[model samples]
Target: MTELSLRTRESFDAVMRKYADMVYRLAYARTGSTFDADDILQEVFLRYIRADKTYNDEEHRKAWLIRITVNCTRSFAASAYNRHRDLSEPDENAGAEDPALKAAETKSDVMKALLELPEKYRTAIYLFYYEDMSVAQIAKSLGTTETNVKTRLSRGRDMLKEKLKGVEFDV
Candidate 1:
């Protein structure tokens, strides 16, 4: 990259403020480690600062950011560093309260059930219900077909339901 000055620091700070938590959560979900997720967040924003790219709209920018996050997390997961390490307890309290999911359940219960899911299934569920992405959009972000995204969501939901059975929480 040519000197790392694609945008003003102020603009980059704005982007970080808006997307940092989302990026962090995505990284955490993939790695199951807070340290690695924080590292990925820094690397993603650093790359964004150095890349010379244009976006037509906010949605496009968000899509690009999500793509970068997914790629970064995948690379992190494949690294020798990750391969040699046992995944740690998830370090963040992830998931938002869903009025549609009211129950006699705590956030930790939902988070624990979510974490018990396989990586792909957890990611699919996060993007669908939490990120509010459509199946087509998720397919595009995940570089899979819509059918595959739908299937992942279905399987993910089933897994979550099984994991959270009798917890009074709805998926």
Candidate 2:
């Protein structure tokens, strides 16, 4: 095709490579389902390709992607199909005999506890801790005030502490 089309395609590919993992991780953290996360990833990038907005910088582009990913995950979770889907309980076994396996088990427990949290709290915790995003950045990405992000982080941490009381989670 034209040079402009080729350049645009290259730019999109680079953007996808740079942010795909971040988008997938955020989506997975929000939904607690790999399938849903994959679907959201595709949708988020589709939206990115369709958007006509101009980014001020790479950080602005990243924030825009984060916002889109969050919105798409929320919409996907709220869809009638997802609402009617059945969620199977995770296996409740600590069958780890080795140190590495035990560590895996601990991580599994922490993920379970994280998944048990409310959407707002989980999103706040994930963005803050896992993504290394500041409260101000999270607030802008989530379309909330920094105060609200701080409150959510505090409440979410308290909830996580309570949920993982017997576990050795450092978060």
Candidate 3:
């Protein structure tokens, strides 16, 4: 039993390492701050560790972690912490210290538009387009209906189009 538990712990750690960056990116996208993202990342993993034994299997575990991260971000967004912070200001130095960083920053305006969106729409857009998740997968991960995910995706795309009309992106 001890050996079995040890193996499970190892497996969980391996999975966390593989997907941590993606999880952090999703959190960062939602929160628009490294500090918040880091907090969410830690909370997500902590939840994973405390999860039930039924939370087995790599795919399900990954989805569960993402769902928790999203939920945590949403909760944080609604809290007083978010009320005091300004969401309009983009982090000029975030992931932008090199040439590649400069290239990525070119899309800062678009990301800002995305950040300004309602949380539901932003989550759908990020999961669908940025995270490259399918509607069904997103629905499963988010515990929503596929039709709802599709609706959100459509609305999000329309919003993005409207917001990015005058903006040109290199990529």
lDDT of 3: 0.73
The best candidate by lDDT is 2
lDDT (10s digit) by residue, model 1, range 1-171: 122233435377777778898888887776555667778999999888877476666666777788898999988878876666555643233354432223313446777677668888888888888888888888888899999988888888888778778644244
Leading candidate by TM-score: 1
Q: Which run of 10 residues does model 1 get worst, by summed lDDT? A: 96-105
Cα lDDT tens digits for candidate 3, 1-171: 122222335566765677789888888777666667888888887777776445455566667778888888878877775656575656445554443234335857677778767777888888877778888889988889999988887887778878888643322
TM-score of each candidate structure, all chains considered together: 0.78, 0.78, 0.73
- Select the stronger candidate by TM-score from 1 and 3: 1
lDDT of 2: 0.80
- The better candidate by TM-score, 2 or 3, is 2
Candidate 3 — worst ten consecutive residues by lDDT sum?
1-10
Error of 3 at 21 (Å): 1.0
lDDT at 49, model 1: 80
Tell me the TM-score of model 1: 0.78
lDDT of 2 by residue, 30-128 (tens): 876666677899999999888855676777888999999999998997898766655663322224243433443476877777877999999999998
